[model samples]
Target: MNQERSTLPSIWSAAPPGGIDRSAFTGKKPNKIIPVPHEYRRQTLSRERDMLIHDVEQKTGCDLVPHWDQGKVTSFDIYGSGHGVEKATVYLNHWISNAHTKSIGASAWAKLPAYDPNKWYYAQVEELDNVYKQRFRGPVPSEGDADAPRHAAVVDWPEDIKNTSQEFVSPREVFGNKLERLDELRMQDKVYITLQQSNHDGHWYLEILGHDVVDVELAREHLTTMIQTVRADAAGVQDAHNTILDEREGMEVELQQCEPWWPNQADYVVPQLLSHAMMDKPGSFRQEGLHFKQHLSLQRSIKAALDDVRRRKGAYDFVVRLGCLALSSKTVSKGIIGRTVSKDSFSKQIHESVQLDVKKWLANNEIGCRILHRLMAVKGFLEPTKSGGYFGYTPETLKETRPIFRGTWVFKDPNSSVVATQTSYRHPGRPAPFQKPVEDAQAAPMSLFVIQIDWTDDEQGMYEKGTPTFYKLPPGATGPKKNMDISLLELGESRAWHFALESLIPVPRKTVSPVLVGFAERVRMKRNYDISSTESFAEWDTTLNIKKYLQTGRLDSIYSFGIEKTCYKVELTAMWYPSQQLPVWGLAVRHLEWASHLAELEDLPIGRQAMWLDTISSFLPDDGQSSSNIDEDSDDCGTRRLKVDDSDDESPRDGIRILTDKLMKLSEIVSSVTDCGGVQI
Candidate 1:
């Protein structure tokens, strides 16, 4: 594959000055020179150099130029000169000392600006040795010199002391009493120093700054203390909360054991129980005033206990009823399977469901059963239900119906081919060949099946109850009118309960082959599946749709078969025709061969894949063109082969070979995936 190369812009911000050449910097023999006036050039060059030196001094805070006065020298002999040569030479020595100090200071700032005075300075052996030689023995020899010292050091010096020497001296020694002004810059980690040059008149000094290191130890200590205090407080609060919860639980247990007493019951039962106890006391005790007082105190205590029980029981009952109602409403809302129901009817159903659930719960609960038993003794008490048990469909219903759908109703036969084609006969008068009979012809392989149900406008009012009122078959006069009518069938109470339960419970989904999953994924990704205006593409999943139809036996619409080709495409759809039914769902099966090949092409670049598709399509017949030609003289029992015209330009064998290679490659891919824990697409 040939790929196009992209040219990128150069990284340099700007090109070098146009007129300058490499030879100018190297000081080599020039190929060409442009002449200019000597005085003009001299003044311009001098000013530029002066500006450069001034800029460097300002930025570095160091004086590079020497300040000295020199008289005319009459002779080349330096020692015999009598024109204040000694004073000028003294100034020259001061300048050299200042230069050395500046050089060391600049190097220190560049390499270790934030050096900690507490930690002794350390450097490479050769580097320290070179610095030592430069400071004591003068400048070292140039690199070009054969006798240059590469790693020279004092033989008498200790190796440890040489590597860990103090690079910067105390400013107090250099500044004397004047160091007090620079004290603010001095810190435990760093200190300021001055580069100075001394003459007979005064001293020239350049103040060098130091790096500051902020101390965060105190702040860190405060934060740690604060965090510990917060955690301790949280633990204390949690402990108190747990103690309260334990006490509350003990109180609730005591309340559950007591019979709930309502205000109406207190009006009659409380007085009666107290009166009975007082009358049952001994005649002698009843005559004494002290015994009477004791009886009254006992009566008051019993009344307070009953009141407490009533309050707790009332609140508990309210919360339980509210929670059960909410739960039942949510269940009813989500139970919608095929159609929607009306608000009034849906609410009624929710209330009924809640009533049933609450009744069942009360009958089974220990406290609730006790309350009901006590209520049964009351004169006007009427039971909520005669049976006092759940009357709706339960798990037993599901168990009994399990055998009805059992046996070999649906089977998986991997060897069975889904596609079927009719054989053409050459003779018009010849009868079809005899076919072998099978014991069970009704049996069909476990393939995808879709069924669509339609409801009319007259049944629209029935949706308010969450189910259609009536169903009508398509226009056909096959059976008697009475037999064809669904309303004619007498549905028993158990059958109605079974139907309701089945509608509420979702159908069990079946798992599909990975190959089908991969194909569905590709179709979804390509958005190649057909859809109606009422349907949303987002809700469409090929795998999920097929599973739903296989499980629920309900389909919304019938899909177009799409353009026909030589490759097999299988589909089975059943739809009902009604005037006002909702839109039907359908499935569109593309050419199996093309679908499998396209899955493999996913690894290829989009552009290349499209090109390959176009190339292969060119070899295949168009939709308008016949896929295969049949010979009329061919025998019905004999194999029916596609008869290709020799006069055609391209041979059919080439196309077949290409398709076969793709299928073989697909098989290899599937085998490899299966060997290593196959992933579902």
Candidate 2:
């Protein structure tokens, strides 16, 4: 076999540049091929792969086979033969028997086998060394004096280094005078010779035919040059071809040791030195023309993917932050400090802040960093106490307290940062301080607590003469061999409560519905979106447009106060109680009653603006007028006319009923929440 095609040596030292004529090397060759048997199979084809082949052949224009198995290939396979050929005989004859051993074949049969040049072939010339001997008989001369480095055209070294050692002999001495002498040693096509220095980096080491070489200048240069060429050739890049050919033929390695806790160590690195060095030449990494260009493209593809993820995360967080802001403070002041309010004014304030902050953040980072920037925008909204954003935790409860949620508000109080007024019902013995008791779990000495006139009704004389009756907790209990007496009020006094205006309100019970459960699950699966914050005005408003529709239904009247459609054009007149009070009152009821607190307090904690639902059913008028006068479904909205009556210098009976009805509605709403397991009146 020809040595060039035989054992496949590395770094072929061909006959000195022009030492032999080409006519002697060319000869008569066979046009037909005879498949060699049992010496080339590396591994058998998988059944699944064969099935895939059958399917592809039926669907596509061509048949396919596994080109390579592991690292070896079946070089003698004879496919695409005449129909008369025995399929079994052809398959068995071509099967490799011992991939590890060399096979003997006649030299006459050694001529270059016929093949489709368009396809690739693992061609090997048999007995290549013997053929070289027969064709070029004599001692092959060196291309230059012993002083010259082997194949000076392919390598360059410091003159001093080249002359310093005998290993740096010329290519002529290494191969010989006959062209066949060089041809005999040539290995498989496209072989590389890597040289390295061993001791004190002065000794040379060679891996004549293997995968890697030691770290040295010669080896580094050769591998680096080859890598550049392969990368360019494989990618079909052409501009830097000449530049790559001129590189030195030696390797240089800087030993990068992996060390513990060392900043400069190679550990955890992606190992790109070889790739980087190879691509250092200009135009070597480009995809001017080639197959699989997209596969090798790393920068643009990975960056775009990252940017997409960031944008999604950013948009989600932006919505969530908007919710918190929408539920915060009011932009416009109403008739009185605590009397009337333009519906959803406070919530609108929060929503504006969320939108503004997110917009600002997104402006700076643009597309790729969108997700991260949006998250930061949300943090900015709550971290700064613009309108007292609720991260979903109660303001004054341990369960509602979180490092991130605990916020501060500006207040005009000498003793504290913020101060709120409150009213409480107490027994005759308890002092005025009972309105703001400091003791925990200590109940006032009162059997029954009556609400103030403002909280009750004059029409029915309710609470004017006798205390309005409601359910009460009976004290005392027994367990095992002991007797216990635990009162509901005793437990209630210790719980956290929220002050809705000046009235002391109870918290609502937490009820879990399938919808709520699904919402909670969605919240949990996300990396952000805390459950407690979802109930806030900002979150609710930003999350959906339905909330604004809900608010419209609860308004009695919306007067266009500003110039036509200009700023401040919409002025809403509404009479509604605080929605945030429910959670405060609910938690209190649950803990005081000694019932299991099944809910997370953060989920119901209201910020400055409570989450609200404005339904038409909640705003029906109380006047005794006939319904035939107006279309009940004209706009599916509710409105109540506020009527004032003076008779004998006293308010009218109907007037009293209106106020009572308002209170009852509040009670009914509370009751509805309690049905979810909150509390009873």
Candidate 3:
């Protein structure tokens, strides 16, 4: 009842923001009984999928199978003014002809006479090797002998192979008839609550959008029957229409007749008129009469569809709400009521309703649906197509989009005792120079910046919340704010370790190993500063959950925290190069490897290989230990056990420190590699 008042005739012209307004044309008494034209225009064309298929088989020597229902295809009509009928018929006919030609070969297509631009034609073919076979229109090589088997006779097209011309031709066309008939039946049984329009012609047409649910299981039957009635009733006609203005008086008189004692009388009558008008208009829908009629229609349909499971305390309602908000103009954020619903509730509804159903809406609107699917993936809501580039948010990652921000690190060259250094990490790859190093390499005094966003997608997926900007400040400084006195390390040239920390080389320089003592001096000059950042903790949590869910499809798996504990384990990773200096190369490599390898694994598949490697690598001899291996029980106690290699006077005690230094270097390499998201490529 409240819904009826909201959609009263007076509000028919109301339009939402960013949409066309037509409310001005509503509510006032009609000057005459003439029907009001539907807002959208409709053009009709001869509809016959089966006839087309038949023609195709006769002309082309091959067979084709239709994936759509023939009856539904025939539901389309050829109607319009100013060549609308001719234009529509020709258009559909040519498409059919083209399908036939393409299915056969260029040779067969060329043999068919040029199609008349103003007439309709039909063709059909059978499925051969699961591909629709049609006539070829291009040249075919002639056989040397007159009796040689004809080249144009028949050919096979494999289902798995790629064929550009036939890519748009789906096997589903065979079901078009059945679906169309179902739609017709649905429309007939439905008591429409709003305006519906035929194609672009302003004529009345009927289609079953949905049905009322007096009973759940029976509703589907009722809906299907309504759809069939609408289609069958209009099958033979090319010119037809329904207008809202035509029924206004009858509704008003009916309301007046039941006046004084009736409760919610307007509700019953208004819905009846709206339904009548909807039936009158075939290919049209109410965009103005009701602010969100289509949304309401689908919502109601969903309610009915889930009737069997509706009684269960499921996440359906939450998903519906979240999807509606996401697709709306609402801004999403923490504390925002609709922003952070659990992924289970948020992702499911969008995946099923918005992603799947809305696709059909576009098709009915004469728009394609493929691009929309891609857009969903871009926003991180739905699983991306196989060819898409974005990773992180897949099921393997707890089905969460990882949020990352741009960040930079500065540190002095360990070889340069005089200066501290800083570094930056970026997307295309890690900050260069550090990724590749030689023996005499010097730490590049540069900044590293990385940007990342979470994988959760909003409704319609228009915005992506990537990483935020991060800054590191010097000690005594509150943050990366103005007036903070800080000295930045001066990078002489760039240098980084190659492979693991096996070697170091200077950026842009071929040889000459830089001194470690100088690099150590650079480190001394630097001091820790304040670090400020906005991390995507939600996304992190989501990714962790997604990883678990991927391992186990159960929704309950999301709350499990197995991965979080292991994420921060203190373990050694193999360095890309042998350089004892902590270079980003080793870290970057390790991260890339992890992303590539783990991205494919579910939480359960996360093997122990990495764990084992970390353990074994931690046991390698420290640098100073190798120099004093002859002694086992002496370390100057533990004080001289430092790992730095000194002169002969240095005792085996120093070996501990040496070993510690080597181990630290190794650990740093492993940590760095795994820390990076993955190689951009």
Per residue, candidate 3 scores C-alpha lDDT tens digits across 1-681 of: 999887764534432213112233222221111110121112222223344433433444322222222112211222122223333333443443233233322322223467765442223222341131111111222356342222111111123322234342211231242233222222233222112343575442222222234322243344333333233323321211111222221211111111122211221110111123423331122112212332233223322222212111111111100000012112222233223233234334333332111000101100112222222233222222111123222333322322121212222211111121112233565344221111343333332211112222333322233332212223233212211011100000001111111101112111101111112122211122111111111212223212322111000001111112111111111111111221111111111122232222112111111121211112222322122233356555423334222223312222223322232332222222222411110
Candidate topping lDDT: 1
- The runs of at least 3 residues in candidate 3 whose Cα sits more than 4 Å from the true structure, single-residue gaps closed, are 1-319, 323-681
Ranking by TM-score: 3, 2, 1
lDDT of each: 0.23, 0.22, 0.22
| Angstrom error at residue 397, model 2 | 64
Q: Candidate 1 at 47: error in angstroms?
A: 62
* Candidate 2: count of backbone clashes, pairs at least 3 residues apart or interchain: 57
lDDT of 1 at 638: 17
The clash count of every prediction, one per candidate, is: 6, 57, 161
- Report the Cα lDDT for residue 114, model 1: 69
